[model samples]
Target: MYYKYPNGDEIYNVMAVYEAHEVYGIPRINDDEGLELRYFSLDEPIEELNPFTEYYLRKAGYINKW
Candidate 1:
């Protein structure tokens, strides 16, 4: 996905999916209407992940920056 900001700045899309499995790169699910996405996710927690909570955030290994 890709889009230009209101300021007309063209930007690459990026999304950190909780489980960026090889199967999760569908061009549609992460595809937004106007914005782009650099989609990504984990590969091990597909069955153990909780999308309704921050389980992904912590397991994503970026909690130190949080």
Candidate 2:
């Protein structure tokens, strides 16, 4: 997914998934920066994730049994 900030900056390749805490969260994709990304509740939309993020999530078994 892509997050367009109010300042016109864009964050690409975002991913959102369910967490063990029973909430949805967006993990940090920037390993080098060690950024703590945002988290969204179940009410939020997670279907807007990017292709690369989806592939990695699936491969890592974050989501399965499709």
Candidate 3:
């Protein structure tokens, strides 16, 4: 998935695994046609994701330690 800042100055291409069971309780992968990109609003609360996803994003420099 690719996340681009509103200013277009920063962009991040993150590689994430498709987990069907995590999002949906199905055992098989999702069968979709086109690419789907989801954007979050600043007012929206952030949801907790899998540890692997967070690790990769952090390692890729998309996130910084405080």
In model 1, the Cα lDDT at residue 11 comes to 77
lDDT of 3: 0.51
lDDT of 2 by residue, 2-41 (tens): 6799999998764555565755455657667755566644
TM-score of 1: 0.22
Best by the lDDT measure: 2
lDDT of 3 by residue, 1-66 (tens): 456678887666656543232253323435685464444322333376556666765577654642
Model 3 lDDT, residue 6, Cα: 86
lDDT of each: 0.49, 0.62, 0.51
Candidate achieving higher TM-score, 1 or 2: 2
Question: What is candidate 1's lDDT per residue for 1-66, written digit by digit as tens?
Answer: 467899999977555545443554346444455564344343334343344334546666633343
Residue pairs whose backbone atoms clash in candidate 3: none
TM-score for each predicted model, relative to the true structure: 0.22, 0.34, 0.33
Looking at model 1, report the run of 10 residues with the lowest lDDT sum: 40-49
List CA RMSD, all candidates: 11.1, 9.6, 12.7
Ranking by lDDT: 2, 3, 1
